[model samples]
Target: MLNHYSLWKYLIVILVFTTGVIYTLPSLYGDNPTIYITQYITEENHQTLDNILLSQIKKILENETITHKSISLQTNKILIQFFCEKDQLKAYQKLLTIFINKYQIFLCTTPAAPYWLSVIKAKPIKLGLDLCGGIYFVIHVNTEVILNKLQEQYIDTVKATLFEKKIPYIKIYKIKNHGIEINFKNSNYRNKSIIPLSKINHGLVIHRIEDNKLHIIFSEIKKHEICERAVQQNSTILYHRIHQLGITEPLVQRHGIDRIIIELPGIQDIKKVKKILSTTASLEFRLVNSAISDFDINNNLIPEDSEIKLTNNGYLVPLYKQIILSGNYIVNSNTSLDEYNRPQVNITLDKIGSTIISNFTKNNIGKTIATLFVEYKDSGKKDSKGHPLLIKHEKIINIATIQSQLGNSFRIVGISNLNEARHLSLLLRMGTLITPVHIEEERIIGPMLGKKNITQGFTACTLGILTSICFMVLWYRYFGLIASIALIANLILMISTMSIIPGMVLTMPSIAGIILTLSVAIDANVLINERIKEELKQGKPVQYAIYTGYRKAFTSIVDANITTIITSIILYLIGTGPIKGFAITTIIGVGTSMFTSIIGTRAVVNLVYGKKNVNKLSI
Candidate 1:
């Protein structure tokens, strides 16, 4: 009878201990300092690090007398391992001197476990930014830029529609926030333009004025939609940029209609991140206009149906007004090398963009195509001498004629170096930022501080558990020892369950959840022991008291835990970030407590006190 275990009880214990261990093993293996390299290598490069780049890295390491462990390129990341954090930093510095920003490098603390462990799909818990040493940024979006861009697009659409319908409009002028106004020579032309303009889908109000003019303005509803869409697009763009950096579990979220929040774990250098956050990069494919008359590149002259674009070199090149394609159509872009081993960006288009490119290229096989690189930076951020750290407007990076008709995919070569290729491809692949964003707030937490927080938190948790164990054992003697054992088991079960939860991040608040659950576990044990003492005082035998005590305590345990479970679920549903972490830990801990308090303690009590001849009650 003492060894009795229903099939369910046997299954529960096995499941808890076995799973708890498998998920917890990775954390115990410890961490090594590794360098994460985001090279942005595209498939078009048709190259791998092991081919050319790896050899160069190895040569540098060997010359510098630096030791390394396993080196690999996975998930578009170059992970170079080292035995000590000191060596990792040393190697990182040495390599930076040679490469000079060829890649985005992160000196990260990576899992020191063997390849076999990773092959089996075991990973350590993801810690929050505060617990792992990282940077936090609160950025505010420029919604006015989004509105003006939309209005410019609408103006183009209205012009094209009037031209297609053969409606004679003398001129079209933009009226800022009021939208585009068109002047017609006569009332007949203005009335005719109205029917064609009615085809606009994005909620525009068109009116005819006494001056034989037509005005189109965005409706209130459309303006709100544009604002919402701009914020969403900026969030999405920022997400891609973060992912491209190869940072794990970095948080990119919308804070308000015009604000965004970014949390990057293990990033110490704030200066390296500020430029990427503030600058907006995009791409344009326009036809080269070589027939234009040669003019002074810096005269600030304006030409008809053409624009002067400053190339990466000092010369300004003329380009047609019509853009053949834009970065918005690109679904993916990556770094690669050309036939000459020169760095290049390979771009892949979405279905619609592919069709547009296929039709255009098919018609103009010998035409020259120019790839214009555009970057918008904040003018307010300056260097020491009051000069802008970056050019505040668009610059054309490269231009080449089409060799043959092509579609779907193409490579942009002539990048100055590998770093340029990586950066250009990264920006192209990430699409465009709908508007500029300003960093409203920024914070950096060092790794030493994060480690200290972890230490103090765990020390507090351990001291609390140890103190509880001593109290339970001292007060109730033998039965209290059994409760202490169950309390240890409760801790183990709670940790194991949390380890297996997908996307569960451990924060300081999560530790609080576990501490609260430990108290609940102790309360459950107290309820059970007191019920047994009451049964014995009523003159019940030892075995009968055990049975009645468990039967009486089961209802209270379920009722107490279930109410807390419901509240935790509600908190998890409404909460975000750290609050969700706390809610999750609480939910898992409550279930583990129920198992350890009622079933685990009872099993030990049965083994020790199952004899029928027992007369004296320990409690």
Candidate 2:
């Protein structure tokens, strides 16, 4: 009766073990090599593939004699399963040539788990880049561009303040990397402008260059703050974009002053990745220069204050240089159809942007405003510093009259098709980069290396677990066998818990954590076994020794595991990349080990020896 457990306790242990085993089933099924083909929208053409396109792809594969396991169609995408990676690669190259500019084709692996397992939301543990093999990118942010933009804004502020305060100045212009310079007629006007200009921005350091000139520059602290903010903003936007792509466990983090390191595990679409990461797409709203008539446009005559921008239809239109609003303040966006059944992007702005747009539209009703779509592209040229040169591309996406005083929301029409509309909406919703970024370094880890890593990790784990089991059994006899069983259960429970937890990626170091956990679990059982031996040496009955041994071991086990959990948590909080992955597995492993080493082994021991009236123990 002393070593016996209640019916409810046995049921709970059984239920937990059963659940662990069930969830762990999905990982054993592995993954299948597959190719995914999705829609790729361009400015010239924006169309989604249909079943007809799927049929054509299937026929092309057949003509090429490429063996495929199955071909299926999903929403706006097609999937082709293959028997092996060779077939998958072959079919990918074949389809990519035919659909080069139209469709996005990429090779990836899909879960081969049973339908029933997936229906219950059971999934395998996510693997890190080192384990799964993918792309690594070291990107450099152009902080100089951000500083220059800040200088321009400060220039605008100085001009606005000078005009408002009735201060006279000859001219105000930016002095490249230094700051803004204000030329005045005399020292009287220059001295008068200093007070108001100094109050414009907290970081501005205003100084008089001469009797008729003043210079304004940002302080060192302010410049550092601006650069840090821009780098952090770029990192956040990149994270959002990668998440929208449905990538799991992507590593996007700042490396140094102006660099970001990104690890995309199991993703093979290099072109798409570069396009999404490097693109700084945004929108600007400006009033169209209606003063220039169609006749002036035909003669290519443009006003000094306006610039000619080509529309998506290849027509040139003049727009004012003043921007009323920018996409930086856009909070949300979605693709929708207008009243005329044409594609449009419905945008919702933040409070500041909403107020700006409302006041502007209220005062300038009936004025034509143009939506400018802007993007920064790599020019295939490098500067003196060996950095890639970025060319700015601007197009007039829409030009329409202000019909009403739009508040927080508005719609832009003239999108070429639904696909383009959707693409634009996605970019706006995910937020735009604060500055341009170029790939400073790129490395592609092939699937073969990943496979080798997996094999080595598996071998290490199997050997560690088997060695632990043998040691435990040789030391404690039948009780050691019970401890060994509990040890194995700890592993299953750990893996299942990792699978259930979102964004938990398994790396090589994670396997090391698993092995370490097994040793700790064995140590716990050894404590119990030693305690029982001590109790038996004191002339105690077998049942009394068993119950007292477990009762005394509980304190030591909890204390040890609690300390380990705390250490793992600290590592998790301070670590990055693979260190975090290792910490995560250790925390999970310690938790599962606590449950299995104590509660799990106790249940098995009770069933084996609890009710028996024995004069001697197996030990």
- The TM-scores of all predictions, comma-separated, are 0.80, 0.86
lDDT of each: 0.77, 0.85
Model 1, C-alpha of 370: deviation from truth (Å): 3.7
The most accurate candidate by lDDT is: 2
lDDT of 2 by residue, 304-361 (tens): 4577889999998888777899988898898789889998999999999999999999
* Candidate 2 residue spans exceeding 4 A from truth: 41-45, 58-76, 176-178, 184-195, 203-215, 219-225, 243-249, 289-320, 329-356, 383-385, 407-431
